[model samples]
Target: MWSALDLLSDPELCAGMSIVDISGDGLETLGSKRHHVVSLYYARKRAEQMGVTVNALVISDDGGDLARYYSKKVTIGSNSFVMNIKK
Candidate 1:
């Protein structure tokens, strides 16, 4: 998925000693923000090479509804590009 991919592509995320990726199925319920999601399928490979744990979780917005956007986050912190995949 692009979201995961974008997050991983971040230099800060790569700089992290560990990386976690989470994704969720499209909102099954209505009245939710429509989000086009992207993720990296090769996270396992990257983890193996980077010697980091490739953690993946199913994510949802508040109320467990559809999400609006896949965050493209990159910051100056040691670990970056972490999306809040919880309520």
Candidate 2:
């Protein structure tokens, strides 16, 4: 997500609005969960600083509150949002 934000934030793009769309199950199976959360926090901060909006599409396989998690930790910007698809 950070890399995508970096690419979209390129000065040459001359984009009026930069948006990063993320779709996932919201599961972190590898590495430390703490590290991942911290990384995501910083990445969100970076996106905010870069004037980029971050949105998320969450796939809820177990009827979990993944959309709430994403809304609190992932989505950013005034227009950013998280849409959950429950299975």
Candidate 3:
């Protein structure tokens, strides 16, 4: 698992600068599982602690309703923040 500090701070090897926000596109399409959702919530929580952001992007072919629904269901117990990326 990658941490916010890992993304925000300098890397051990490659000379790349910053990672900015950690994003996971298509996180849970079917909204059929919460395991990965919980993982993402924890990752975002850690990122918040490190003053970083986590972009959990889930795409929906159903005009974003599926994506929005997926986010809603996953964030229920977590109360994690989520946003829609309009195309």
- TM-score pick, better of 1 and 2: 2
lDDT of 3 at 85: 63
Q: Residue by residue across 1-87, what tens digits does model 3's lDDT show?
A: 244445455455453432333234454333666343445456545555654433345544446774566454433222344555654
Q: Best-fitting candidate, measured by TM-score?
A: 2
Q: How far is candidate 2 from the true structure (C-alpha RMSD, Å)?
A: 3.3
Q: Least lDDT summed over 10 consecutive residues: which range in candidate 1?
A: 69-78
lDDT, candidate 2, 1-87, per-residue tens: 878877886777766668999988865344754453437778888998988889999989765578888898888999998888987
TM-score of each: 0.29, 0.79, 0.40
Task: Evaluate residue 14 in candidate 1 and report its C-alpha lDDT on the 0 to 100 scale.
Answer: 45
Q: Answer with 1 or 2, whichever has the higher lDDT.
A: 2
Off by over 4 Å in 1: 1-16, 26-41, 59-87
Regions of candidate 2 where Cα sits further than 4 Å from its true position: 28-38
User: What stretches of model 3 exceed 4 Å from their correct place?
Assistant: 1-5, 9-25, 28-38, 56-58, 66-87
CA lDDT for candidate 2: 0.81
The backbone clash count of each candidate, in order, is 5, 0, 0
Q: What TM-score number comes out for model 2?
A: 0.79
lDDT of 1 by residue, 8-68 (tens): 6677654544455545544233333645422243434454454444333336546432333
